[model samples]
Target: MAGRLRCPNCAAPLRLAGRVLRCAGGHAFDVARQGYVALAPPRRRLAPGDSPEMVAARETFLAGGHYRAIAEAITEATPAELIPSAGGAPLALDLGAGTGYYLAALLDDRSGWQGIALDASRPALRRAVRAHPQIAAVACDVWQELPVQDACADLLLNAFAPRNGPEIARVLAPSGALVVVTPTQSHLREIVDALGLLDVDADKQGRLHAALAPRLQSERRRELEFTMTLDHEQLRALIAMGPSAHHLQPRQVAERLARLPQRMRVGASLLIETFRRSGAAGASA
Candidate 1:
């Protein structure tokens, strides 16, 4: 609610008056009590991307700083020029942003930066906006056109989300960077094996590269490793943040949890890749 929200139709800056957001051309949208909107029309609704329980679990785990390294890397890589408003006032976008933890962490590292946190879950955005004043939480599907304008974002962060690379490339200006963080094979392997769910595939990076080749060029790639030991409550929270948690039955999950040690050593791996967008990408959602 700082700068006028950009009009989804024409990328014009919107005017906020009372509970309504209106573009210069007179297209109007409503603001919810949680301070976000549904820009996607009926035709665009897909499966709900995240559940309330998942979002809550993620928020709990992230608040404990379990993913601190990734947040630090993101802060370090933010280009100075892209941070338009100086004194740490950057305009960043966190796509499929769950609980706004990474964005909140980056803002903490570099003060005064503002961000737009987008997710399909209203519950997640509700929790996110409360965490930081700088963030403008928006509930929207990632597959649809993002609500912001072209070349307006300093950094685009997608952590474990469905990516539309061409669309991401369109929104980034020259020298603007996109950071995609995906889990590696060893990450959550023990849980996956125990739950009888799909394992992290070997060709995930290759598939990402192939999918993103049209609009992005990789600038740097780094592998991060960390170990987190969780008590039962933390273990339950961590498990609920993943896809397996959604797919498994409650009793089955409880049974498996009972079998685990009082404290479990969980090793995790992440690939942090920074990319620059190629030209020829257009704003088509």
Candidate 2:
């Protein structure tokens, strides 16, 4: 854990001193030996976020370029029209940002875009801040009100994380764009079947629209599909990026993985949907 942890309770700047992150306001949070802090309130303990291992897996899997297409899609869908007149860099939020890979990709060439990388997992936040200096890694959950001020974000990017449409709406600047990237139904289909995981349903898009219809207007949607070849080590990395890594027994995964081809052709699919936050007349009650 970094010494300079911000106090979640009092919004005070904190510094690491031995075992705890302490603020002048006297709020102290213990740093777990495994390198994460519990920032959630008691009632929010059950909120589902990535575990430390899951974060590691995502970091490794994304580092391999298997997900480059998603990154490219994000760049292509950026709201270029909103960049000017803002007078400063665009404010982008990577909700559930893991290791800051995607956010870092978006921040690469463009100057002046301040990124807030929010995640419940402190390890992920730590990795994010270290990986991307431009990002301010905040430890928080997405389901609750975002810690940011209302109408401040120029764009919100939710990739492979749960969505809170109303919460997202409140945080977006009027005309702010909401870009969501989700796996398509057939995404990693071969691997899902081979590994005995549940398949993404055909109704995923319909449900997405149903959830956001009243509060958002979909501007555009694009689907990307590609194939990548992975060795055994890469296969292990990919498995780690999923829930089965935590849910399934190690023996089961190992046994299944052992039977896979040394370098297999894996299909990947993703949908990039951009929406404008409905405000005033378009606001959801």
Candidate 3:
């Protein structure tokens, strides 16, 4: 876990000792029995991320393979996966790696690489730690400085989560690449009206570019759209696993879901993109 991670307090390299990760400056964090280390600064008490229910819902929904295509696209767009024989075994970092589903895919194609799954949610990291044997899970706020070393990660991944552009560019290896997955408004179109879901940001793509700026260069972008026929329980899990779960009451969820058919078809759309450090040779537009 300390392979590419730095101490949250001192930003020094961390070394594992017994059940704790410690920096040369004496800052120490105990690794939980659940196999994840929480790296958030203790004083700030950053707000909790995905709740237990949300994590469970996501685990269930993803295990259903509804978004398998999206995961595959993320892995395919990653440049590092193709060069598994790179000098040192490459490292892949997943920002807001939820349950490690996408990271798992990337690792599947790259035999020798290891993955670091970063998420604010302990519940998500817990699942991530268990999702794959080669994955190391860390709990850290995405908006805060990531507890990772500079220019260490060979690949970075972001899926349906926040992106910290500067932190991302700083952590990526000079020759590394980044893959991001964001949903288009067309995603779950049928459920949007029925479930009172939040509207997908209209300027999401424009804002993404602005945030990364000259620090990162865009390489490729593609939209993969698909359909799913979800049953009653599947529909409920789909809504519960998203941001809507925070605002929707149980009664409201039940009431809205009650009106929808037992099984309904919905479109799934994701904008997948790949980027490289701006100064990298042949960095794309």
What local lDDT does model 2 show for residue 49? 67
**Residues 25-60, model 2: lDDT tens digits:** 887767565444555443555355677887888888
For model 1, residues 1-285, the per-residue Cα lDDT tens digits are: 424246666667777788887778887778888877755544556449678888888888888877777788777665554545223356778888888888887777666667888888888888778777788887777787777666667678888887876668767655567888999999867666765655777998998898788778777788888888877788777778887776777687788888888887787788888777655232122
**Model 2, stretches more than 4 Å misplaced?**
1-48, 83-88, 279-285
The estimated TM-scores of all candidates read: 0.88, 0.82, 0.96
Q: Which residue pairs in candidate 2 collide?
A: 3-16, 89-112
lDDT of 3: 0.87
Write candidate 3's Cα lDDT for 95-118 as tens digits.
999999999888888887899999
Error of 2 at 96 (Å): 1.2
Q: Would you list the rank order by lDDT, best first?
A: 3, 1, 2
What TM-score quantifies how close candidate 1 is to the native fold? 0.88
- For model 3, the superposed segments whose C-alpha errors exceed 4 Å read 80-87
In order, what lDDT does every prediction score? Answer: 0.75, 0.74, 0.87
